[model samples]
Target: MPSEPAPPSSSLAERVARLEARQEIEELKYRYLRACDHKDPEAFRACFIREGADIDYGELGTFATVDDLVTLFERIALARHNEGHLVLDMHHGVHPEITFLSSTEATGRWTLRFRQLNLAEETERVLCGDYDDRYVVEDGAWRLAKHHFRSLWSLTRPLPKGYVVDEGAHL
Candidate 1:
């Protein structure tokens, strides 16, 4: 039997650089999700590029600029009702697949397990989706250039009467 071909080798510096880039991109995704859950519009906006970003959140809306998305996000996530937030959200991102297209550009795919509580409507929603993203190094940091989310499934149900939710100290 013929011996298997040798795998390509990269220098230690190159390997380390690639690893660091991947870590930064992963952190970026985490920050984005956390910002959404926490209703931090500034942090959420910081995760994407300054301009000309392509964002498509399906039924939520499509935006050419990060600012546009931020506006809508503020309206929905920051709404107040009865001395409490109108909507509460939790985002859990998993199964990240990051692929490097170049030293300064990359693509990532992630699965999002999202849950939301609408206090005004007394509904609980659960959704699962896939995020297809493009990242680029801008001003020495990785920022999202393209973000598209395709929802796989979602369910919404009315909360039981007299149900109580403990928001905890975090809220």
Candidate 2:
């Protein structure tokens, strides 16, 4: 048999640190998605840096600050119709490709599977997109420094008459 292959060049500590950082970053992305689905503006805002973040969501608009994005998020996501939420959203982020540029800086790309219900318009939309993100350590935590979303495709159609959605005790 051939001689044993050489081990990785990085030390155990360095490898562990990198793994932990990746886990934190992935959790951050999931939290952001959960906030969107739950309509929690505070949680959503917490995902990004406090200021001066490059955010682009295509037709939804772009912002240089988290405040601007939160303002718009509140206007649309918090709207109500017929004593129920005006819009319901679900976000599934998958196939993350993360790379480290430094111990405290990294980049990630994710595929997004999105679904939305518009109560006011009686329409449903299914969309697929890609997210390009930059992450940095701020105040000892990973935060989104740059976020860009490009929609690959979307399908929107009117909901059938007499159809209803029951939240069933979950918001």
For each candidate, what is the lDDT?
0.91, 0.90
What is the per-residue lDDT of model 1 for residues 3-30, given as tens digits with 9 covering 90 to 100?
A: 1222268677777788888899999999
- Stretches of candidate 2 off by over 4 Å are 1-7
Tell me the tens digit of each residue's lDDT in model 2 across 1-171: 101222479787777788888899999999999999999999999999888799999989999689999999999999986667889999999989888888899899999999999988899999999999999999999999999999999999999989988754666
> After superposing candidate 1, which stretches have Cα over 4 Å from the reference?
1-7
Model 2 scores worst on lDDT over the 10 consecutive residues at: 1-10
Q: What is the model-wide C-alpha lDDT for candidate 2? A: 0.90
Each model's total of backbone clashes: 0, 0
RMSD of each: 4.3, 4.4
Q: Which residue pairs in candidate 2 have backbone atoms (N, alpha carbon, C) closer than 3 angstroms, thus clashing?
A: none
